[model samples]
Target: MGLFGPSEQEIETAVNAALDKRASIENPSVPLSSQNVLSFLGLDATSSAGERVTIESALGVPAIWAAVNFLSGTLASLPLHLYKRGKSGRERDTSALGVILHDAANDETSSFAWRKYIFDQVFTGGRGVTFIERSAGKKVINLWPLNPDCLTIKRIDGRKVYQYKDGKRTVTYEASEVIDIPFMLKRDMLSHYSPILSNREAIGLAQAVTKYGAKFFEGGGVPPFAIEGPFQSPGGMQRAADDMDTAVRKASKEKRLALSLPAGHKIHQLGVDPEKSQLVELQRFIIEQVARIYSLPPIFLQDLTRGTYSNTEQQDLHLVKHTLRRWLTQFEQELNLKLFGRASARQYVEANVDGLLRGDFKTRMEGYARAIQTAQMTPDEARDMENRPAKGGEADMLHIQGATVPLGSQPIRGIGDNGGPPLNDEGNNSNAA
Candidate 1:
């Protein structure tokens, strides 16, 4: 029992404190906050959390919101399963690590809730942190996600520790207890560069241009008015100019269709051509630029300027293979390393990208038909892929069109009905003239 209390929790805490004191004294706390992290690191203070490229700022930009939403939403939609190595090469879903990852809900949050949160943070901040709470025998029972920005990684001597800063107090965690997933490695291999930070200048340009457009439309894109009337004295001319300016502004504010001018004064029209301004084309180019920053196809960003029927499918393939593939691979590797121990080679995580790869109904059906006819899979398996319940009797059997015993059982038949070898490129058979 602890000196201060008879409770087990208090006793445990006291014992941990003694042990920690004996090992290595805790370092003096260095205060941190989401707003000052960048400043602490000698970076531009304007780039700190809630300042530049923040979740709010990101969502405020339509292009950024669409890119991040598409990426994170797609990840959260996949069903993660816990799998184990069975006899031979077959696998089954029953591992403890898999169970923890497949549904990471604790007493506080649901699987979907934390999964979406994790992906959103990972893509935005290029990092995600989850603290592990283990039961007896070191079995993980609950995991809690922490704000990536508030959490900092620091190495002391040879050991690494994680610090979660809340105001002036920082709580420390050993590296082994926190699952830190980095989107991509930086120079030191411990930190990552945020995508939003790298693209801040471009995003700022887009925002500036948008604001300019808004103000331009507010004035109806009209230019300042000019006058050609004469006044006798300098003061008289100034007063006349002021009177004319006030009258024009009041007329515009009241939305009057007509304005009165003196007999000698004439209204000069200031003209602007929308085409010469290149506003539409400039906006289109900027949207395309934003899409390229995230490696997203222009179509995904709703920029369909260059879209064509012939190239649409190709673009889809490009996104799946080049863009999504890279992100998914990183996620899978991190999951495999953290959830399943590094030593467990055969048991690893994989995403079913077939959802993105699925073609039109006819094409998909034809491909499945080929698989079934070649004994690659049963008809029930094909149906199961389309989320249809398997028929208990007929669909279980594998069949081929060759009138054979089992698939590939009979030798490939001769080329033709002549019961002879096939003709060569020279149009002559070896056995016949």
Candidate 2:
């Protein structure tokens, strides 16, 4: 200790401790080192059901797999278009960047495949990152996907950057050079919360239920049981138990209806049966929980227990509005920001969700008819939407229904030349046509 107070080293240590505490308070996420240790010890996010729910294990649950696949595939199947603001209005952009976004992301990856992969990563790993390759003239040429597992994000000089570890070297990219979409961003903004990880307990329970059902059926629909026998020693009791187990398994395998045990031995069921435990109901409930995690209806996960004709139709609209719309908007904005830059207001990217209605031909046709009749869309535009050839001439011109006309322009049949009905002596129509 110093003469009047603590030593310089002690003061420094106290200051460091305070700073560390404040940092922990501000950023509550686990440190990378601690996460590594937890992972190494196989203790990361173990659930009450004793299942370790990682991304792979969570996906092993059929409901979770279906949710991720359905969402990613649906979003990827939508048509993405690039547009440019012009004097007339917004027009489709036919530039190389447009082709890259709408058709192919690179020479080897189609746009749909790339988008699916990106969203798969987002749903599974919490983040999707893609690097933009630019030519000498600063024109974007190709887009390459980066593995989120090997990437680290940090804020340097007030701007976020990505450092990706390649096979042997580390490459750093500016924020503008990469497109990043996170399922959910944390308060720190440097890390993201993975859907699989955030709800590990629920997913783990689902996995546990699936495993339990599989084991139950594997034993020929028999619940686990115990053996009670009149044995003289431990070895004799063990042998008797083993014999009983072999006999039961053999009987099940050979499709025999009966299993014979020794006169002195008896079998006792150890646990409740599947039906008593409500395993089927539990499994269906788990599916609903997973659907909730993805903001999807249970019907989408193939759970029709509560589905009705009216509610199922409403669920379709709910999927598009609540679930798909959020993801589509996020993806579109991310692409526009990364591909066009913040200052470039003229160019943007969009996803055409109208393709979702193509499967319902009646609904699509009705929508097109309304749009054309109201002059919101030309007949040729509606035909093009359906991939049909235009009729040319009048088909390209906007046309409204004949019954819709300017107000106060209808002619009065009985009016005089002065635009009033000729006054009879008693104020009746004169019939002066």
lDDT, candidate 1, 1-433, per-residue tens? 3222222223333444545555654633433233343443334324322245444666676777888888788776676665566676657566665666666557787666766788788767778778888889876688788887677665679787887876789889987677777776666555676777666767666665565577665554545556667667888778876887677667668877576777787767555544566768877877887888778888888877799987888999998889878877776776666655678866766667787777899998999888877777788889988999999565776767555234544444345546555555565764575
**Tens-digit lDDT string for candidate 2 (1-433):** 3333332234334445555654686765544333344544343578889998778989889999999999999999998998999999999999999999899999999999999999999989788889999999999999999888778777799899888878789999999999999999877667778899789889989989999988887877778888887889999988887887777678889888898777877789998999999998999899989988999999999999999999998998899999999999999988888888888999999999877645487888888877776778888899899899999877777777553332233334444456665556655667655
Task: Give the range of the ten consecutive residues with the poorest summed lDDT in model 2.
Answer: 403-412
- Best prediction by lDDT: 2
Q: Would you list the clashing residue pairs of candidate 2? A: none
Local distance difference test scores for all models: 0.68, 0.83
Clash count list over all predictions: 0, 0
Residue 113 in model 1: shift from native, Å?
Answer: 2.9
Per-prediction TM-score, please? 0.73, 0.84
